[model samples]
Every structure is written in C-alpha cells, then in structure tokens.
Target: MKNASPAQMLLGLRIHAAAFVATIIVLFAVNVMVGPPYWVGWVLLGWCIGLISHWWSVRYHTSHRTDPN
Candidate 1:
C-alpha cells in the first residue's frame, strides 16, 4: 500500500488517541465497579506507550518529509 501523507498520518494518530482515551475511560469505570486489584493502570501504561510511539513516529516523518515541489 502507498504511504499515507503527513496529514493523513496525523489524522490517524488523533483518531487512535481519541479511541485510546475513550477505551481507557470505560476500562477505568469497569475497574472501579469490580473493586479489586485495579488492572486498568497496566492497560493505561501499555496503551500510553503505544500512543507515544505513534505520536513520535508521526512527528519524525512529518519533520523529515521533503517537499515534492
């Protein structure tokens, strides 16, 4: 598949971040209801790493991109 444009990559990152936040909220609610070991923290940490990696990847690509002109 062709590579996405920088704008597309950024948009994808935003969508991923939004979904991550929404999912984390639901997970936190569930964890609270369960009243136990609180596993949502682990999920948040792991997903945060992934999200940061995604953001870094986008930033690197966009900053390094050469204009086609």
Candidate 2:
C-alpha cells in the first residue's frame, strides 16, 4: 500500500469515508424505525473515530510527501 500513488490513496480514503456515511445513515434510519437503540450511536462513534484517524493519516502523509526531485 505504501507504493500506492497519492491520488490512489486519496481515492481509497474517500471511498471509505463515503461508506462510513452510508452506514451511519442506514443505522440512523433503523434506529428511528425501531424507536431507539443503544448500539447505533456507539457504532457511529466508533466508525467516526476510525474515519477521522484514516483521514488524518492520509492528510499528514500527503502533505509530508517529498518531491522526487
């Protein structure tokens, strides 16, 4: 994965973020339909934490990457 181009890595991260958003939306709808649950929020929180970490790592590496010169 380290050999992946910056564009490729960014696209992968974006796809992951999109998946997280979709999952959260579905979970929220399910919660509303079921009249509340203790797990949806936790699931969203956990996924969000992971998503944030991924986003940060991508951003950090993208910014820090040195030009081949």
lDDT of each: 0.92, 0.85
* True-structure lDDT of candidate 1: 0.92
The whole-model C-alpha lDDT of candidate 2 against the native structure comes to 0.85
Q: In candidate 1, what are the lDDT values of residues 1-69, reduced to their tens digit?
A: 027898899999999999999999999999999999999999999999999999999998888887878
Candidate 2 lDDT by residue in tens digits, 11-61 = 989999999989899988888888844579899889989999988888888
Q: What's the TM for model 2?
A: 0.85
Supply candidate 1's per-residue lDDT for 65.
84
Question: Against the true structure, what is each candidate's TM-score?
Answer: 0.93, 0.85
Give the TM-score comparing model 1 with the true structure, all chains together: 0.93
Pairs with backbone N, CA or C atoms under 3 Å apart (clashes), candidate 1: none
The C-alpha stretches of model 2 lying farther than 4 A from their native spots are none
